[model samples]
Target: MPDPCSAIVHPCLPQNIFPLFAPRPWTLNTLHIIHRRAALARLLNPSLRLHAITYSPFSTTPLHISTPALLVCLAHPCLLGFSPLPAHPITTWHCQSPQSPPSPSRPPCCHACSPAPPPQVPVERWEEAQFTWEPFHQWVMNTSVYRRAVHRNYPMSYPCGVWANHFYKFVFIRNRKAASTTVTDNFDKCHYENSDPRLCIEVVSLNRLKERGVDPAVMWRDYFVFTTSRNPWSRAGSSYDYCSTKWARTDGPCRQPPFSAFSRDPSILGKISNLFHCFDRVGMYHDYYHTEPVAPCITTETGLPAVDYIIRYENLSSDLPEAVRIINQRRDPSLPPLPEPKIYWKKKGQAARSHEEQGVESNTAALVGHGDKYHKCGMQCVRDIYEYFRVDFELFKIPLPEADPAGDR
Candidate 1:
């Protein structure tokens, strides 16, 4: 499609990108010898070969040819794909090849006496260096780990990292805005073969072990465990929007969802105050700071680590199906397979697509640091989110985005 250049190679990845093959250096004259259509293609797409082209007025080499050292795409290189040359490749060719004969190919203007002013601009162009917030924010959010789930019938989300149903022999561990709502709803309907499916409610880590004293190994051993993830940038954005937008509207007092027939179970259902925390800024943050944060729940620092599969939000269309197939195989055949978790979004969540309203997620958990209050999410937002969720990102092998000098306002 787009000449598969930057997409194929990048500055962060050097010669290591093509460890198997290497090419010999070719000079300026080599390019001109190519077929006419090929030259035309270079004229049409410069970055297709050179990321950016430069020229100097005092060079003896004809203005027509540039000897880099460039790429299939062009960017980081000495002159060719080969590295270990000058730290910074010459942006503008300064060679004065006196022995080389000027080709008839040199423009008629190349009257040796007064070569045309090095063409004001390269015939073809490449990168756009402008780094703004909105576009970058949007791009970061739509990625596999950063994608947010929102659509008609926005499933009610309950941010919990530990959830398990002994009856169904499955466990789920994840963070907020990761389709926990869909998993929770499906488990509610999946009960032991003959038991009351209506009362089949999954329990959080606190309830399963602390409150009910269930064995930790029960949830960890031989269970069809799974989890979900969204890009931290988008997850933070979704959390801010859903809690304040047309959905939960956390700006006001809000109540957690009631348990099923087990709603009356004092073991799973804690005190009324615990259930009805104010969703206001103070309330929501208090709830998160006090209750479920990503780390302490999912990290081995707090408990045993176990997960059979992870459903990434970005690949939901395909990932969900694969996870379902595996879970059904391990689960009891009589138990109806869990349905593909549903998704939901809000008016503001869809439009804002920004982090203007939130702060560093791990800050709420406060397990790592006390640095919080990043309300005006900007270029630094990606770095801040990654710092707190670094473990999760690394554990799943998600690539961290390069941070910019922009302040974390």
Candidate 2:
């Protein structure tokens, strides 16, 4: 195949440096280096997709990229003929599907820096325990929370991806982040499958089984419905960095505010006003995604747990396999498992750049990276995020860490 990078990289960077700085099948890790090298080549470009308020009955919508072309001459997947970039580098203990051979104790070379994964587990263990397969699946469906909100008209604000077809028995509703580049790319690179090929059908509702006008419990009995969550502290830092890159207006969501100020403020974490109130708002669509509470957004209006699984982001290497296993089982179980899961990891963040380049508040700069965020923000930030997403920690049973992670390390 022609070098996908040749045309795109030419204007901003030399072709030769690509091989030297990063290896074949390049990634954002390489993009960071390219950004530093091509400061003069920064293309002040933000494609219309950045602000797309897209909705469809079937999932598989176009990717929503915030800053399509930053100063970097590289890293945007769209630039590489829609290739998926590698997931962010985990410092240790990351891996491929449970079936793949275990990585060596350490990578043979520095270039092969991906953290080693645990030994492959038998495929039987990959999923038999997922949400749909849960013994409590019946109870979760019968609970008042699910029943009351099944037909009630909750505000349809969040985005979700879906894959429904004849052969695919389990009605897996890929949540709002479903069609996202990171998850899509991460699919069994083993299978080279991203969104399901039966993509044309589009229906709204991350509340997956509700709109079918049938009992969601029975309707979803076979499908392995599930969603994922991340640590609120890391989640917040990531949100800050993303918004900073897309930051344009001061009054709107993702307007790129100081981290210390943003995390502690209750309004930023808990605000999810109805559409009628925010309909005419300038950044209404963008704001809708940012500040909504963890539980409310994922559950039924009457406060029912909507999904069967909660794949905690921290436990992804172990958890993602459940989703991957079932999806493959539906299609072809014999396919090789995906390579290193493609999660959204950023070694450097845009907020630090904003603070460093634009001289943002000193406090904000100190709290920029994930490790720096919680400690630097202090106890108040931790308590606030915990309270904001209280149901998540409680229902999911995710333990709250001490305010500062540095102490634990």
**How many residue pairs clash in model 1?**
13
- Estimate TM-scores for all models: 0.40, 0.42
lDDT of each: 0.38, 0.38
Cand. 2 Cα-lDDT: 0.38
Q: List runs of model 1 lying over 4 Å from the truth.
A: 1-161, 189-195, 204-214, 245-293, 302-305, 333-348, 351-378, 403-409
lDDT of 1 at 189: 35
How many angstroms is residue 69 displaced in model 2 relative to the true structure, after the best TM-score fit? Answer: 49
TM-score of 2: 0.42
Report the alpha-carbon TM-score of model 1 versus the true structure. Answer: 0.40
